[model samples]
Target chain A: MNTAAALSIGVFLFTYALIISERVHRTVAALFGAAVIVALKVVPWERLPEYLDLGTLLLLISMMIIVNIAKESGLFEYLAIKTAKLAKGSPMRVLILFSVVTAVVSSVLDNVTTVLLLTPMLLYITRLMGVNPVPYLLAEIFASNIGGTATLIGDPPNIMIASAAKLSFLEFLSNMGPIAAVDLVLTVGIIYLAYRGSITVSEGERRGIEAAIENLDENEVIRDRELFRKSVAVILGVIAFFFIHDRLELPPAVVAMAGASVLLIWSGVEPTEVLEKVEWTAIFFFAGLFIIVGALVETGVIDGVAQWLLGYVSDTGQALVIVTWFSAVASAIVDNIPLTAAMIPLIKAMGSSMNVYPLWWALSLGACLGGNGTAIGASANVVVIGIADREGIRITFLDFLKVGAVIMVLTVAAGMGILWLRYVGV
Target chain B: MSIFRSLIDRKFRSIAGDRYDEIVKRYREFLLLPEEFVLPEVESILIPLDRFSGDFHGVLDVLEAYRGAKVRLVYLLDAQTFRLIEETLGEEEAQKLLQVERERGKRLVEALKESLEGFGLEVQAEERFGDKGDDVIEMASEYDLLVISRSFGSEVTKTSPISPVVLKVVQHVLVPVIVY
Candidate 1:
């Protein structure tokens, strides 16, 4: 490698080490890396904008604003409470319904938000039922990753994949949805089986809890009828546009921003308040990441890495397996967002020389599913664990791994098989 | 395409240029109350509605002990629970619950007021939406003393004697807490 390549590679490794070590905030680490790259003139300062993925940033901001508005309108809590009511105090039903609901919501809104909305209400219901909420919380986390794996906008990794691969919303659904649906069912079932005999609520207690829930006025949850209607309308309109954005020759970012604008106009919520709710830390982190990754692309380091991987794979099936397992395992160790960001360029470089369409699906499945391996594997897991900790329910890494590791392995293995059959064999 | 690029480009630059920690700190500061308001003198006692057993008349013994101390009755509908209900049921239902909770608080206040008529103690009723523990803590600073009964909603129950929230409130607040 030449001087620029060596320097670029060194900076990239240093950034990754800092991020993985948790020594400094990720945003800080990423910013330092990006600043170093720019200062070194690896990519000219004027070309900084060219390097950043504007599409991804815009989509994230717009989505954040939309979700924040929905949150303010209390849409998420409404859904979770409605789903909890369906359980009617049965421990087994609570686990199943909550897991399924979490997964489905994660598919639409993002896993972290889903967990944030669900955990408190789930705990409340579980407490009322006189059951430990640990199992229910864990199942929700697992289901979130599984459910988010199915769609383009569900998980950060999938969003990165869509932006990088130019994949459409429908394409993501067609490729990964069926397998993710199956994984969610299996996940809920596994969680139920593991905790079924442990929950010892008596028939009398169950009936008592059920009666308490029946007395709860569900309609009392709505804080504002007009805002809820408006928020729901905007969200539904955004979803509809996501389906046909390609046909309209509109970018996903455009559709998202337009939806956000319409909501702002309709709701009359202050722009600053909406902007304050945006996850600027993640956005900034992504900006720095894109710069670093762009440096790698400019230096041909990604191509080198891609060539190294391609040399090992004899056929498409082996490539699919390797990518899926590699991504899954890597994602378990590090957060899937940055992992996906770094891998996108390499995957693209690999695809240029051969038909590697299946690899995208494999990467999506692995990165998202792998997030269930440990408490820190994904944003959703970490947030859920944090909430549990704050609420005086401690979940250690080993405690999470005992459940998460099993689910991660099973789901990833199944994902590889699905990719092999659907993409490669077909 | 260029206009879109420039617009996004401006955003990306700003995102990179901005300090997240500083922004978050500013936002946190913005969220805090502008300035602390001076609390009223500690001549009254504060009690949560649910803490009283057998409705408002349940605190008769404590009222008899205090003699001339005024009473402030607070009935809380958990803000988190209220928001959850509001989202699921609609505004109409949420309003009804608020009305119901308020009505319940008023009745409790009235009963206490009737019982304490000869004692020359003032009676006040309030319906709040939030964590009862937090509401109690915030109110504790202003009260001379808090007379409360341990209830099911308390984090520290008979089983878990040192409840997380109640204990924290006791530790943080300057006022004395008398648990019945």
Candidate 2:
């Protein structure tokens, strides 16, 4: 490699190290790296925006606005409380309901938002039910990542992949949906097996807690009934339109933005307030990370890495397995968003020899599922940990990895098996 | 007949005519209704919201007993605490932390309001920034009664079933206090 390629690798590794070490805010670390690259002329200043994926950025922002309105209306909380009531204070039932709802919600909304909205309410329910919230919270983190794999808007990595590959929303759902569906069920089963002992309550205690919660009128949390109704209608419409966006020749970002606008006008919420609620840290992080990844691409570092890795696998089947495990392990070690961003171009560089479509699926499955391996593996995991810390609940890294690593391995293995059978020979 | 009967026959018939039976029927129906379904004689209730402690259910039970009473829930945001957090974390971080507390307060008030509504009470939520105990005690005079929770805080003791704020409220408020 040349001097520029070596320097690029050094910059990338240092920035990544800072992010992983948690010594500085991940966003700040990424932005620092982006600044360094631009100052060093690794990537030209004027071409910075070209490196940033505006489609993914716009998609994230629009969806955040839409979901923020739903949250402000207390729709998600209302749904969660309803789910809890359905569980009737049984700890096992509570875990099931929460994981299912969180997974389902993450399929449409972003994982971090799904986890954020659910974590507080889950903690409260666990308190009322006399159970520890950590296990349920961990289950939710896993569910969110798994569920996110099923949809384009569910996770940052999926959005990046969709944006980069020019794949439609329907394409992602069609290819990734089946395995994600199976993985979600397997995830719930594994979590139940692992946490069932701690989540148990006596029959009488369960009934008492159930009776207490039955009195909570979920309707009471609705600040605006009219706004809630309007948001639901708009969201339904958005989902319906998402299915046909490709046929209609529209981008998913446009569809989401249109839905957001409709909600804004219908709900009469202040645009500024809704915007403030958006996770701008995530947005900036994506923007800066894209530029750094672009620098790696410009210097042929990704190509070199891709070519070197390809030297080990001769056939498509071997490539599929290798890519899945590599992505999974790498994603578990680092933030999946950055890992996926850096790998997308690398995968595209290998597009000439294999069916790029299956590789995309493999990467999507690995990166998304791998997030459950460690606390820092996914944004959702980090956010959930932060919420727990604020409540004086300390979830140690090893504590998460002990359970998460198992689920990650199981789901990633399940994903590889499914891909092998469906795309390759058994 | 007595003079009253004679007066009723002559004066009351002229005013009532044939509509008197319908009016009397309506009056009887009103009296036959359950007491809880009837509107309360009292005007409104004042609740001193201590951020840290309250049996939400018990408070609602008290409100249930006064069916149809208007409720005013006062949540005092302590400015001193906000300033302290600001000093330590700077403006943006402080605001974020305060925003979380504000959300918690709002949610608590809303939950109470909903429970009160379930009991047919008209509810109003008020947020003030000051010493919580002093504000609640001062504001208790505006309403007919003060209904506060007996559970003092997240951490409770038998010596203090009621929070210090509730204790101050009980000592100084002009209205009768109902400690749930």
Candidate 3:
């Protein structure tokens, strides 16, 4: 290899190491790496825009602001607790509800936040009801990973895929979304069968759970008469605009940012506060990541990787199978967002070599599914951890990793099978 | 048993990026007004709606003497004078301001109720809505003490120095007003 190539790889490796070690905040590390590459002139400023994709960043920000408002409504906790309350303290029933809700919410918003919001409530519920929460939390994380696969905005991997593939919102719904839905049902089924024995709750357990719910303070902001109506209108409009904006030649970025702006002004949020809540770190991570990935692409590294991987699999069908398994494995340790972003160009370059665009679907399925492999596999995991810690529940990384492995296996296998039968087998 | 104990004893930041410890420290001082007081028989206690914090159980522990007081929980909502929001703005902007006011009102009310149990005031919360001063003055004749909450709406903007309606309620009410 040449001096420049080795230097690029070295910088990337150092950044990844710092990220994994948690020695520095992720945003700072990402910004620092991006800045170094720019300062070193590894890639000139002119090539920067090619590396950056504003769609994913804008989508993330738009969703975060919307979700922040949604959270204030107390709907997440209220629903979870209300559902669990109906279970009458059955540990197994609670586990099922936790997983299902975690997945549903994770598919729409980030899974990390869903788990974070639910975990403490889970812990508190479990503690009060005299039951263990470990099983339920593990299941919740798994469902979150599986559920995140259903849409373009559901998880980072899907976003990376959407941006890289230039696929529209409808494309995902027509293809991998249904596949992910099936995989999720299977995951829930498998967990229920395995944990059925532990679910049996005595009457005493039922009463304990009832008492806990009775203790909840339900003075919800959902009662905000005017804001509630406006917030709902603004959110529904954002959703509608996301799907139809393509026809108007309005990019998803403009629609989302516009929706958020309207919601802020119309619903009475100060501009500064909304802007402050925007996670510039995640945005910077994308900006820097794009530049780094773009640099690699410019250097012909991506072409090399894509061509080799494509060459290794004779038919496009085989490549699909490989990418699915690849995503599941890689996602267990590293976050799927950056990983998926890193792979997009490579997939695009080599996608035509395949029998079809099957590899694109494979990559999407794998990256999203891989998030279930470990607690840190996606952004949602961190959110869950943070929320749980606030409520005094400690879900260790290793604890999540253990269940992550079981569900990751089931999902990867299911995805590969789906790819072969749908795109390859025929 | 050890795990349960640890969970109950746990301490962490409350709001994202807020110095919850400092807030707690400030609230502890506010709750201990008058410095010293003799024990009173358990009967009734007016939990001044706004002067409370997320430490209700601890507060209840201190006032254990009032074991069975039927607690009247009052939430003071600042009816938010609309001069700043209403001043010199287009009709669209004015409507938007009203939207924010209602959301701010609900968020504050919910947050207050959620954190109330920490004080262990066996409580019933009543939100006396409308502009804070006039509404609170009218209701002061009925309650033992008025709890003062930190202003729920935006800080009195430089554009409108209306001094907030909560202040007016504190001034006019014959009953003692608790402000945090």
Candidate 4:
């Protein structure tokens, strides 16, 4: 290997270690790695923008801003209360309804944000009904990952794939949406059956909880009705634009940015206030990762790996399975964002020798769904688990893995089957 | 006294010119009058209760010490708990939960008032939302004595340390306190 390739690989592996070990903040580790690469001239400073993938960054930032502003309007809380009330205090019904809402919301928003907004309220409702929240929380975690798989912008990995592969929103929805829907239903059903005994409440307690929920006023949760109306209108408009952005010859990033800008002005919210809430750490982490991964691409390390993989597995269907299962297991061990970041270039390099379109679907399915395999597998899992811990409800790593590993295997297998039928035709 | 001291200090500053600060420092204790300390004649009593506090009946014997003292029963709806909810959920959900807690606090205070009044003591009740320790300390100044349970701020077992809120009130409040 050349000096630059060795240096790039060293920096990338070291940074990946730091991120997974959480010895230092992931953002700091990534930025430090990116800095080392640029300082050493592994990837020239001038070409940094080339690897940054401005579309993915912009899309992430815009969605964050939109979600932050929308959250202030009390829309998410309103939806949660409304859903809980709709369940009418039935633990099984509540579990199913919340899981479905979490999936649909996570598909539209990001999984971490969706869970952060929903879990506390879910805890409150379950506590009121005198049922365990662990099963519900687990179901939502699986549902969020599954739901986030359905759209181009649903999960960070999917967003990165769409940006790199130049796949349109409609393509992602049509390809991954069906499998995600199926997985969500199956995961929710499995969770309900597995934890039904724990979630079950007596008839008297159910009736009392029903009365309590009935007394809750969903409308009272809306802090600003006008802002709520504007946010909903803009979000709906954004979704509509996402569907037809391809026809309009616009990228998903542009659609998202336009929506975010319009909402900022239309809502009359201070720019700094909304901007302050943006997850800059995640954004910078992505920027640094792009540069780090770009170094591997520039040094031809990825190309060598791709060549080796192609020589080892000449059959396209077998390659699809390898990529899918590998992405799933690897994502389960580390943050999917970095895992997907490293894989994007390798997959692109392999595309030259064979049809790699199905590889993209496999990567998305494996990386996104694989996050459910462990407690530390995804940002959403860590966030929900942390929230649960703070409330004195311990969801140990083993407890999560027992359920998460099974769901990850099931969902990834389902995704693999769908990909095989769609692209492999067998 | 403060106003009079300020006038005297100004006059002294004019006479002593730049030497005023040095003179005040040398005789600071004499210059600043010492506050008079007197035994508190307990007439009005402030009792702060959280949901986990022991029943008022457990403290009735203590209350009988200050016979005919007006009792103010204040139920504290802990702001910290609601803030945690807000941090995890959104502000709207926290507000809704706070409102529910406030209503529950009101009901608790009202029930306690009726029972306390039955003992031939005047009783007034109010519900407040704030940090339990800070609120108890702040409210204790209005009454001659503070009556709080050892489990005022949090649930405790016999082996647990005294409640932090009760400890804080004991340390800071100028009024006499009865920690039952």
Candidate 5:
């Protein structure tokens, strides 16, 4: 390898090591790596913007602001309490309702935010019902990953893929949505069966929980009715805009940004407060990651990897399975964001030889669903586990792996099958 | 000579500004304080209850020893719990949950007060919202004796260690403590 190629590869691997070992914060590690590459003249400083996908960054920021504002209205808490009340103290029903809501919400919002808002309330509800929250928390973790797979904007990897491929929101939904729904059902079912004994409540305990839940006033939880109304309206309008944004020749980021701006103005919330809620670390992490990955592309390293990957496969179908399983396992071990970041360019390089459209779905499915493989696999998994730990309900890595790995394998297999049938034909 | 001294003082003040004043205030407040050695007779007793774990009944006999003493029952809604909630949701939601927990704490204090009143001791109840150990320590000086449960800050089993809050209160409070 040339000096530039070797240096970029070394910096990338070293940065990845730091992130995986968690010796340094991932953002700091990524930025450090990016800085080393630029400082060494491996990737020029001025060309940094060429690699940073503003669409993905903008979409992430806009959605975070919107969710932050909406949360202030107490909408998520209200929904959670309402869902628990709807369950009427049945443990199984609560599990189902919570899992479904988690999935549906995750498909629209980011998984981390979805889990952050829901997990605490889930813990509270389960504690009240006198049921073990482990099963419910596990279900939500899996469901969030599965649900995030259904839409382009849902998962970070999918957002990166959509922005790169110029895929529309409807395109992602139509392709990944069905399989995500199927996986959600299957995962929740397995969880319920596996933990049925622990989640089950006695008759008297059920009656007591029912009485307690009755006293929980969901309406009282809504902090601002006017803001809530405005938020719901803007969010719905944003989603609707996402549906036809392609027809209007608008990028997903534009739609999301417009919605965030309107909500910021309409809700009369302090912009600084709402902006502070944005995940700036993730944004900067993405920026640095793009530059690092861009170094690979600039050094022709991605082309070499693509050629090596193509040497094994004859057609897109075989490549689909390879990409799906490979991405899944790789993402299970590493953060899916960086994995997707590196894979996007590789897929583009491979697009030169074959119809690589199906490969996007494969990458999306594999990367998004693969996050369920371990407790540390996805941001959502880490977040929920952190919250659970703080609440004195420990979910160890192995404990999560035993369940998350199985669900991940099942979901990825289903996604591969759906992609095969849809694109590769029976 | 006085004018020269004033000029020097003005220069020092300009250089140090608020930090100098803060240090002076702290020095006056802490370093110059008189030492207190006398222990007051047990005329008023304070009992800080943990909503989930403290054993109020275990201290009844201790209270009965000071039969006619005034007992003040305080239930503090744990700010730590709401802080955890805030980490997930925002501050506004955590505040709302704190309000709910405060109401619950009030009811608990009232029920404890009613039961203590039945024992013929003059009891006053107050609900607070803050760190349990810190709040108790702050209020400990006002009362002659403090009766706290072994599991003051956390839910515990027989094998569990004494709560950190209990340890802190024991080490820091000036009053005599009865850990039930």
Candidate 6:
């Protein structure tokens, strides 16, 4: 490209890089970049609305509303307490409980919420048993990300991807659900190796903890009875609607918006409060990023990059390896949502006839697995970190990346192999 | 302070002090960068602070969004105010204050997060208690960003709006302090 176009994209990258390095406020960064692109007329200011991605926004808003109400009802604490009781005192038991609890919570709610609620409890529970909460915390974080993969609602990236790609809940279930289930089992296995020493249990402490957990049940945490009852039904109904949205020919966003509205009307949750929970900064960031990416697309920069990569990895055999590996690494550095979106059209263009469906599955695996690559790789990682800080256990970037690298590689390999066999007759 | 307590405090202060320098550095960097930014693949964050001056969640909400992509937040508390609030307001009243704080904090964070994430950033929130604001500065750099609330300073001088301790934090630590 010419110097001016190159200069604009470079400016965008530098700004994004600064953000990646956390040298700025994300919303401000996004807005700045967007304003520049608009003002400079790189992609023309008129094209902004086309990039809104409203489907993604509506789903996120609805889910945020749903989760906010659920938290109000003390749904997360209830799950955590119940999981601890089920696990008793054995470290292995703790891992099992944490994995299950985190996964389930993340699936219906979001990974961030799951970690926010469970990580502290994990820290407190582990410390109470005289063990380091780090390893368990990591496992819970990984498990939450994995578990959230089973359904579209589990993670925001996935939700955005599903909505943007027009994939149904069943599509997510069919492709991601199996991978997530298998990934969890493998994760639980590896964690068994990671924390073998801490999993041991004494009979007395185990029962004592279990009995204590039973006493302070969710009812104790949730004081509002009617609100609680209303939320339970809404959460359940939303999930059911998501699952059946495809069969009914309904877009997931429609279902989400409807669910959010019902929640507002039935539960007496103020619309203002619900709107407040929408995470506007995140929304603006997405809009700005879209414009930035659109700026690249408009200038044919992404197309150029896509063409170069497309030529190198055209063989089905080579393409699979490259896509999986690149996805894992690329997702680790860049937020996977944008990265995945940029790639979809490119992958289809290059291997239009090679059954890109499996490749899509590979991207899913890579994006999800890659998220474990760093503390910033996925929402699940951030959520648990937030909770861990509350308990005084500090997990640095290097500290988390060290373990995250291993999990990403192992799960991506395992997920790729599973899909290969099913689709390609490995 | 007893000898054992003194040793723990000294070690904690060292950690927190170091953390404070890093926190200031991050905030400075955050303020300086161009507005169109994308954070690193953030997963877990570690913030070590001594004590906060109350308005804990409000302060946390601002610093927390800058926490790389996909956040796991860790807050180091002073345990002093943790107890004070528990005692003065008693467990029930303190919890009520905390509950209100959590709700408001959630709203604000959600707003901030949406704005930030809209630019491709993810955030996770966390907290802990130790002694005071002085105690967490040492460990501030260990996190993506360190935030010390004014609650830490409030313990020593209840009459003052912003205590000398908080001023020291702003002056000394390299991190950011959302003082109210």
What's the distance in Å from true for residue A286, model 3? 1.2
lDDT of 3 by residue, A1-426 (tens): 565566667667777777666577666777788887788777788878777887778878888887666555555555665665665666766777777777777777776566656665666556655555556666776778777777777777777777667776667766876777777777777666756665556887577566656544443424355665676777778768768766777766677678777877777766676677666767887787787777677666777777777667787766676777877788777767667767788777785676547777888888888877766666555545545555556777666666667778887788778768877676
lDDT of 5 at A193: 75
Compute the lDDT for candidate 5. Answer: 0.84
Residue-wise C-alpha lDDT for candidate 2, range A1-426, written one tens digit per residue:
877777778889998999877678778999999888988998888988889999999999999899878766668768877887999989988888888888889999888667766776687678877787888988899989998999988888899999999899888888888888889789889878877789899999888878877767788777689888998999999999989999999889999999999999988999999998787878999998998899988899988887887787677788888779989999887778888988899889887666767888889999999988987677677777766765777777788889999999999999889888888976
The model with the greater DockQ, 1 or 4, is: 1
**Per-candidate TM vs. native?**
0.73, 0.71, 0.68, 0.74, 0.72, 0.67
* Poorest lDDT segment (10 consecutive residues) of candidate 4 chain A: A382-391
Candidate 3 accuracy as TM-score: 0.68
Minimum summed lDDT over a 10-residue window in model 5 chain A is located at: A382-391
List of clashing residue pairs for candidate 2? none
DockQ of candidate 6 (2 decimals): 0.02
Q: On residues A1-426, what C-alpha lDDT tens digit does candidate 1 reach at each position?
A: 987788889989999999887678789999999999999999788888877988889988899899888776657667765776788878888888888888888888878777767777787777777677888889989988888988888887888888888889888888889888878877877776777776668899888777766655555555677889999999999989999988988878889999999999999989998898788889999999999989999988999998987888767788888889999999998878788888889989988667778889989998999989987787777766766665677777788899899889988887777778876776
lDDT of each: 0.78, 0.80, 0.64, 0.85, 0.84, 0.66
**Which has the better lDDT: candidate 5, or candidate 6?**
5
From the highest lDDT down, the ranking of the candidates is 4, 5, 2, 1, 6, 3
Model 2 global lDDT (CA atoms, 0 to 1): 0.80
List interface RMSDs for the candidates, in order: 13.3, 30.4, 10.7, 29.2, 22.7, 17.3
Instruction: Give the chain B TM-score for each candidate.
Output: 0.60, 0.68, 0.45, 0.68, 0.67, 0.42
Tens digit per residue, CA lDDT, model 5, A352-408? 988999999999999999989987677777766766664677777678889988899
Candidate 3 residues lying further than 4 Å off, grouped into runs, are A1-7, A85-90, A203-223, A247-249, A382-399, B1-180
Candidate 2 positional error at A161, Å: 0.6
lDDT of 2 at A424: 91
The docking category that best describes candidate 2 is incorrect
**Candidate 1 lDDT tens digits, B7-67:** 3233323332332233223223312221222343457787765432234445566567666
